[model samples]
Target: MLPTLDARLTAAAELVLPGKPVADIGCDHGKLTAVLAASGKYPRVIGADLRPGPLAKAEQTLEHAGCKDRVELRLGDGLSVLSAGEVGTIVLAGVSAQTTWEIIEQAPWVSQVGGPRLVMVPATRHSELRRWLWEHGFALAADRPVQAAGRWYAVMAAEYTGEVRIPTFTECLFGRTAEWPEGAGYAAWQKAKLPRFRLGVPDGTELAEEIDKLLDGSPSQTR
Candidate 1:
């Protein structure tokens, strides 16, 4: 593992196919990219961000990991610095789901075969992002939640195959509840988060009820 990669990177790494090239967007400190390179998963890892400061820091991280040979740092907004067919996969973490989806929408190169695939962990607007992906062409490849430093986060992987239809408004908000780490633990977890999300989203009225209704409708969970 790269020195700076956290548990989220670890989970994302597990889902990535080995020997592919990857573009790490918003690669703060280049930690995740470094880890992917060191793990010998992606042949080349590109650490990209808009600011020179983060790129500089990422350069240092790659150097520290001695995976610098396999890593390249690019300074640009989203995937702008990368050319078509340059990267095999794209990883965007710690950004809003809206930005994540928008970046994908803007980058025509990503739709190419053997081009950039995307894995994103949006900081917020997750519901919107989920809806966007399904409406577009991507389908959920993996979904798992991890607690890091006392905060729970969902790690989502998606691939754009074709017209991914959205089933309902609730499904968009909750995602594939059939696949939501089915378990009693997850249920308890959601119960705890409801009040918070309710309090957080302005006019979270229908949103909260939908959550409760979704939970009740879900099948039995695991231990």
Candidate 2:
């Protein structure tokens, strides 16, 4: 039996297109990569991590799962080990939005012709990541939340479409998360953050009210 992946990892995998090579960046244990390979959904899954310790752990997990042949383990900085169009899908989870940006920025090949799809789960700064994607010629395809590890995480899928689009204020704040159950929880969670948000940022009070109303059965206020 394949090792079960945590909710966040599972959500990330669901965003990837099947039968394509996948690169799981910062793949801590390779569990998700292994699962992706074992499912026969992808022809190859690359588990890339900067640290040797975690990559080694992933190696053991893949070996035990008997997917070592299908999953390639690499130790290098984000996306540095990958070439243009090497993998049509890439997964970035358990990292900050800034880190995700840094990884992608350092590797411009991802946005080139036939570039890979980005499936990311930022632990924080979902709004920042979303805004970055819009400004960088990538279009947001999916934005949903997953309840995992005693918290909620936003998982997103984007493609390098070469057309830039701006998201509304609410969409940046909470993403399309209001579209589902975990999104409701995500809305509540962001609403709770309003009280502690430092001044000089966007108006938390106004944003909070909007979120509250949205959660109270109002239509999605997206643009």
TM-score of each candidate?
0.81, 0.88
The TM-score of predicted model 1 comes to: 0.81
Query: lDDT values of the candidates?
Result: 0.72, 0.83
Error of 1 at 9 (Å): 1.5
lDDT tens digits by residue: candidate 2, 61-81: 988999888888899999998
- Positional deviation of 33 in candidate 1, in angstroms? 1.3
RMSD values for the candidates in order, in angstroms, are 3.9, 2.9
Error of 1 at 73 (Å): 0.8
lDDT of 1 by residue, 1-223 (tens): 3585576777777767667778888988888888888888677878899999988998888889889889888888988878887766778899887788788878876765455567778776655787887788777777666666766556778877776685554555455434655424534555565656666655557655665565567623321
